[model samples]
Target: MRISKEEIMDAAKKLEPRLIAFRRDLHENPELSLEETETAAKVAAFLRSIGLSPKLEVGGHGVIADVVGSTPGPTIALRADMDALPIMEETGLPFASNRPGIMHACGHDAHTAIVLGAASILVERKERLAGTVRLLFQGAEEINAGAKAMIRDGALDGVDEIYGLHNLPTLAVGMAATRKGPLMGSVDRIELTLEGRGAHGAIPDQGADPIVAAAAVISGLQTIVSREVSPFSPVVVTIGSIHAGQANNVIPHRAEMTGTVRAFDPAVRRQLPDRLRRIAVRIAEAHRCEAELRYIEQVPVLVSEDGCLAHAQRTIDWLLGAERHAEAAPTLAGEDFSVYLESVPGCFFWLGSGPSDRAEDAYGLHHPKFDIQEEALAVGSAALASIALLRGQSNHSLLL
Candidate 1:
């Protein structure tokens, strides 16, 4: 007894008001990574309201609920991140963040709401369900630590397949997108410290100027993607922060830089840290300074399993019209959902939340002005519910 598109939509429509309220509440009371205590409690309460018991604090404020069907079958997981960014709210919506210096600018509020909506829809159809549906509300996605912690706490125990979605503000509302492989890039953190000698501002060759070395290293890093990496492979090396001298006259003995590296291919991702370190060290040495580099591989590339993606695509096409979905090009942006895909064969797709005709209303993710179109809540919930229903009907294994 598979649920139909009409049935899913009807349930989603009925839950729209509640979904919007949930999203707004979450948006108003934003919480940073690993400290989602209040948010977790709200989610648990919602799950309980749907007649499901959620395991709270699976991994430091993470929540998980299992909706077992009438009969035994394969288990499918639907995940949503429950964390906010550090940016302050500027959207000025009535339900804007009440917490200063924290905002749901990344659409995690909508993601969490949509998943809860799906849980309600799924719960209504539980009697006809063939398998179990695991609802995962993850924390710390912005810092890329939540997924790993949840997995360590047994979130993926006995899960056969998983699915998740992110809200894309650039795409028009009512549209969704995903690709067959490498939908998102791997993320790696980079830190470089250049050591030199300090001296008076007017010193004549009395001090080793690390600031000069740091500038040269930053410039040299730009060439890694242009020269070293394959032209076809996508890679990004950006130095987001740098700290050097304080005084106007004195040369600083140390300069520190921090940045990020992203790549879609595993080979390219693996080689980036070494290449970046080599570039920085050699450039620093050329300036008569020593360099220390620290590279931490944060998350792996998010590649959707073909079989699972096919299931998702079919569901999306049926629910939103075939033309409503597009094949998304691989992006350099990293998602912690990549961590979950590593353990279970799954597909991570994007839900469109941009304003329909008002281009000015659409703001990129992480921006203070960022806000999702409320209409996307219904679309996302329906899509997630349909995918779970479609996949639960089969005992098929993913072609990993």
Candidate 2:
């Protein structure tokens, strides 16, 4: 039998205190990407405490647990990231990070807590459940490596479908949003080095000014989005850092630059590297300098399968009322969760954690002061649990 909204809500309420405590503990002891040893241990311990045996170190600190239901049905996987950023904590909450230079600025702690809470609820209703629910606590999401590692380790070996959510601080609390097709863009890192002869600053003709070439290259890259790409297609080329000369009186031998590229369309993403390289090389040649471009394609665009998204939206509507859900526009930010979606049909949604009263509580993700409204814990947990239960029951069809 499928779990009802009321039942999930009640379970969430009863589990809220424990959920908050678990989230706080994770928040206090944040770990970095690919190095979530302690965090992985804690997650495994929590799963065991709830009578589930989890496989540890699946992919360098990733933890996976399976909760088999009373009967056979489609297996669904739920995932949460366990890594923190390099930023220092500025949110003066009592449970602020004890580890300096690391903080849960992206709400991964809350994601982990919500998934654990869902696991607890599912375990309680195991006898009524129709299939298995797999919990994936992933590491290194910040660096976009964890999901791939987990998949390599066979996290999705028997998983029929997958689901995950990120906390959106801008969305009002008690709400959720998702949509079909591309929900998040692909990310590529670009590095360029312009080589030129060094000479005294006073002798303009003696040296090839790579700094000038670098400036032109940066300007030229901007035109790729505005002129080369379709205006309707979203793409971004941002030069985040540039390093040239050390002394004011001397020309530098080389100028180095690093930036990122984001695109939602696959065609646009595939052509970015060649276009950027062409732009850099031609611009550098114009200034009598040699250019080397390194473009590393990272994560792919996160697309939601049509059926999975419909199911997720229906589940959210049922859990929080139809009025509480919205169709989220595609975002440029990249998520490693896209890795898992590549292997399985799934939907990744956004859970609203923004506060209604305090503007400070709406601090965006990755900001030092970023935080989620604790009440979102219950909303996310209940929604996730409801989705799993509904999907697990073979006879249950979404009331869309």
Candidate 3:
């Protein structure tokens, strides 16, 4: 049976205040990946308070807690990110980040609180469950290594399935959505440097111009998506940074450019490095210079497992009913959740946190002023608990 909406609400109310405080506490002392010392300690203490013993620092800075069910069943894992971004806080709220140059602009604070709330309900209602529930407080999601680290540390050990959530600013609070296919793209960081002979600006023929070749390479890179890739498929090549010359009067010997490459399929993502490198090198050599291209694979393409996604949808329908559940378009943004899904069947979804305004381009996620309504916290908690309860009755591996 699906968990009742009333039960979800009841649990949310019971855990809301506690979670709010916990979120605020985390906000006041934000930490980056592999550096969340206090966050790890608090997560351990919170798990202990919930009557579950959580193993700490499993994957450098990962935390794991497992609650066995009353009956023999599978093990389901729920995860929350514990790291903050390197952004300065500007929300101006009293509980705003105390760390001057770091903030939780991605709503990980809400993710943590919601999971903890689910833990509280799970502890109190363990008899209703038929299997085990594992909680993963992962670090370095922003840096795209948390899930892999946690897996190495055995976070997914014996886990049959897993679930993750992200906060969406445009979708409105109390709502949730996701698809069974590619929910997010593969993220790769690319840096290119062009080298040429430097000379005085007045004598343009005296030296090869690296900046000129770099500019041409940047413009030509767009054709990769527009002409090279399949017409149906989408790809984005954004060169966000360019640095080189000290002044306009002199032609610099070197030009450095950095950008991100995003694609939905592994085949396409893998081929990007070769494609990008060739384009950069050829473009630079044509200008009597050379190009240095380096591709840093950050996050892999986030492919949601069909079985796990179906189960997640069922749990949502059971808890929120048909009216409250909806389909959503996938995004080009990437997530580290791909690592978790690799070891266990699972899906990562979004929870709408309402918008700042009705405008189509209103302040959204990752914005300094972006803030999610706190009530969504309750909704997220309920959804997480439902996943745990539903998994208890499915395939014995549902909990794994």
Q: Of models 1 and 2, which has the larger lDDT?
A: 2
197-307: candidate 2 lDDT, tens digit per residue: 999999979999999899899999999999999998999999999998899999999999999999999988999989999999999999999999999988999998888
Indicate the TM-score of model 3.
0.94
* Candidate 3 clash pair list: 74-399, 75-399, 75-400, 76-399, 159-400, 160-400, 161-400, 172-354, 173-354
Stretches > 4 Å off in candidate 1:
358-361, 394-400
Top candidate on lDDT is 2
Give the distance in Å from residue 57's predicted Cα in candidate 3 to where it truly belongs: 1.4
lDDT of 3: 0.84
**lDDT values, one for every candidate:** 0.90, 0.91, 0.84
Q: Candidate 2: give the clashing pairs.
A: none
RMSD of each: 2.7, 1.7, 2.7
lDDT of 3 by residue, 1-400 (tens): 3345687678788788888889888887889888988899998899898789988888888888987878887899999998988988898999998788899888888888888888888888787787899988988989888888888888888998999898787876767887878889888899999999999999979999998999899988998999889966768899999999999899999999999999988888877888888889998999998999999988888888998888888777766676667687878888898878777788888887875355235467678876777777888888888788777674423321
TM-score of each: 0.97, 0.97, 0.94
By summed lDDT, the worst window of 10 consecutive residues in model 1 runs over 391-400
Query: What is candidate 2's local distance difference test score?
Result: 0.91
Error of 2 at 16 (Å): 0.8
| 265-309 per-residue lDDT for model 1 (tens digits) | 998887887888889999999988999999998999999999899
